[model samples]
Target: MLFNIFISDLDIGIKCTLMKFADDTKLSEAVDTTEGRATLQEDLDSLEEWANKNLLKFNKTSSSSVERDLEVLVDNKLHVSEQCTAVARKANRMLGCIKDTTSRAKVITPLYSVLVRPHLESCV
Candidate 1:
């Protein structure tokens, strides 16, 4: 997640790691620390940066499953997908007779201001 932290915090940490790896053309020291993983994923997830960097990938055949946040996984895979969709579909059908706007944006804005907008701005 993007955070509005001082750029020095990110830039120095990032520049140090890049220089460390670049100094040794053979990559004698591998980055396997927690901080290293965070820096690597940040670079990989960045559109402009990742395209300019070398990619690292795993073979599908060599992949193994780890617990994933069901709502965030790509295309909704995992056993939870099946259960969530089934429940949601049934709930939607159950709501077929409803005609209401009581749960609309007008009623939700005050609550959302405290919950969502500030987080969005900070992240961006």
Candidate 2:
């Protein structure tokens, strides 16, 4: 059986929260500023140390990679360019729904309702 792990320090205001479902585990932190990024890095280092102490091996290669220097929107408002890329202009199929480029039209099928709707609705 897999044991759950929880680590929180109220005195230092450090909470390394994680959500686990079956074999999937996710860790998230808001790093909008330099200090926040440093804290998150420190927390990750501590987590690595704890895992080593417990003899729990982690897959470092499984971590996702983000493309650097890409412009991201904030608060749903465009900050950089108004033009959309070709990939962004095409329809995206997610959770059984075909979301249009403009997001003005959505195509949903019966399969979506039976399989994808529940998973999408349960997302936090």
Candidate 3:
């Protein structure tokens, strides 16, 4: 598409990796050192410049310390405990609902697989 062609060279001369999917563009780099942080900032500046040159705009507010993708929450530090906890809580609630609805042991296994297992599996 024309949009893809226009931004295809957006990663040129950049040290970090650029992941472009649909309307989302993500820039990723390890920021373990001061130099690494500077490199990330430089990449951000380059992206802003590219947007300005192409007459495109970025939604600044969407840039956050934590981002959710594929039902997984990832923070800037790459911590996923919050995601695990959230998924666990959701699955627990589903289990509780199943418990309240049926006393049949055989039915619970099928219900759990259909209703609760996906959350546990996906978050891991």
TM-score of every model versus the real structure: 0.19, 0.42, 0.74
* Model 1 alpha-carbon drift over 4 Å, by segment: 1-102
Give the per-residue lDDT digits (tens) of candidate 1, residues 1-124. Answer: 2222312232332323332221111111245897766656665345234323435232326344433332232232334454445455544443432223246666556544554444333322
Please name the candidate that would achieve the greatest lDDT relative to the true structure. 3
Candidate 1 TM-score over all chains jointly: 0.19
What Cα-based lDDT does every candidate model obtain?
A: 0.39, 0.47, 0.90
List ranges where model 3 is wrong by over 4 Å. 63-66, 74-82
How many residue pairs clash per model?
Answer: 0, 0, 0
TM value for model 3: 0.74
Between candidates 1 and 2, the one scoring higher on TM-score is 2
41: Cα error in model 1, Å: 24
lDDT of 2 at 10: 17
* Model 2 per-residue lDDT at 117: 57
True lDDT of residue 68, candidate 1 = 31
